[model samples]
Target: MKPFTKLVILLLSITFFVSCGNADDDVNFRLNTGDGLGKGKEVDECLNLGENDLILSIQEQFTTLPGKVSILFKVSDSDQNPISGLTADQFTIYEQGRNDDCFNTISTSESLARISPNSQVFSNNTLLVLDLSNSVLSSSLTELKSASISFIDNVMPDTAQESFKMAIYWFDGENELHLLNDLTISKEELTMAINGITDDISNDPSTDLYGAVIKSTDRATELLNASTQGDKIGAASVVLFTDGTDQASRFTKDAAQKKVDEADPNISFFTIGLGGEIDTQVLTDIGKTFSVFAANKEELETTFNEISTRVSERANSFYLFEYCSPKRDGSGENNLAIQVKAGSKQGAVQTKFDATGFTGGCE
Candidate 1:
């Protein structure tokens, strides 16, 4: 064959292989083409996607209107570690009850929700409540500060988006929760607040651990409630650290426990105790979500790191999956499932969404 003809043939062969590979990977759909392909009825009706990523967990699912549903979920590895950097192409949404036995795949272009590269989707608020009692200041103040700074560094990303914020509060003998720093996304600011802690920051050195729990939980609950009322999704993490028991007795233990129990589930509570001075049972009850104890000051950082990992993972794990549903009110309730594929690994989850109020056509 002529050299030019040979080159042309090679190019054509490459293009054909590439096209086949893409079709094997994903079925791309043009959402608004107004053609039969864009009308949501052209793709394969397969019920399964072979294998799926099993580490995904769905937390909440709700529909704002007809033909649209939003899901809040988390993705983790086999060891239950949060997985990040996933994109919309890695997922295939299927709906069964809306149509026939075959599952219809929601187009990637129609997926409005995705795992953000930044922390935008995960609007997280964290509160660090410290007990600045004399007992803690006299013995392990430096260790506490170091451990706290480590936690802030681990949890707070380098570039602060509007989605993530942190605040610091210190409690002495008083029943009040003194604010060391207001909510801010700056790691430097949070570190500065921790470093600024000194023995003289509070006039009374007695620990009001119970009061701190009550006040911090209340504050977290308020933040979460405000976010919800404002039509935004938000989560809060409250980490309380103490080296001794509640000495002020300004608030009863039962009151503090009740406050925590009554707090919103969106707010996660974490407690850290140093030495034997702290009541493990009390801290555990207060930190029903998670609790850690350090035998001494040297182990504070390790304990704090464990809690920080959990909080940060939980904060960052949230993934929002939004898609256009084919079902209308007449469809009643439908069976929905999501399968995630990342590289060669796969996971799947099944959930149901109501089409009771589904009205206008899906966007």
Candidate 2:
């Protein structure tokens, strides 16, 4: 028989067999036609896949279960715009050992990332420390309250994650560091706490700015430590507002600055200074992450709002990605490479994880 006639017969026979299979069978099949040159292949060779230009920025990753790994990442195009509308099938995972130079692709069925949208697994905490000394109260008490309320409104979104919380604190010349409100997720509670601040609330007229800084940093450190031990990721931001120098001098400048420097790297520090009496150099040194200054009471609201905007953006940018691992318990340490494709754009990122407990089969 001629070659064309034989090919026709073979195709017909295969179609007949598939049509006659049992209806309850769960198996699926596909036919791959050869390239024009007759080199049988599943992919088309004529299509052009230009240079890969996507950005897969992986922020944080962890192993949540015996065989599952979770990653927090962001996807952006070459122009830096966030890439959306991507499905789980668009990702390909490859695995290799520490000593291997080549990566072997894991099966799409076994190692695909189950992309969860807008899932914030990490915890975020914010400490708002205010100076309630005579200097600030006599000059800008009303303005201060307005700014504080605005900051709370901006930071706490309508659909905030359960892990997001904020605390309010105030300090004066007296050694006591008053807690206006403990860490909470309720906007109403925070607003009520800010409204309660008044000139008569402070017993001393002096400003113990240094003491407040030390206490606030210590509180943030404790939170971070507790969360880590509880197997939860924790991030804290300490924003202190002051309008004058440390007049009480209860704690030395060196002691206060040392506490900030020794703080956990995960905790961010932001300082807002109002009026000309504030020591710009000292506030700048204290605000390790960010600092803003207001010439007078009029600018206080704007300064607080600026800091609030930045914090909100950072919180929303994070993501969580999880996948099952092909490695078994005794596979030792291995490397992971993830590739993403959207339209014709593509990019890749690599990370390493220890497989000491990577056992069991995924469901």
Residue ranges of candidate 1 with Cα displaced over 4 Å: 1-70, 75-90, 96-99, 106-114, 117-122, 322-336, 341-363
lDDT per residue, candidate 2, 251-275, as tens digits? 9999999999777756778899999
- Could you say which candidate leads in TM-score? 1
Best by lDDT: 1
- Relative to the unseen true structure, what is the Cα RMSD of model 2? 21.3
TM-score of 1: 0.70
Q: Which 10 residues in a row give candidate 1 its minimum summed lDDT? A: 31-40
Backbone clash pairs for candidate 1 read: 52-346, 52-347, 53-346, 53-347, 54-347
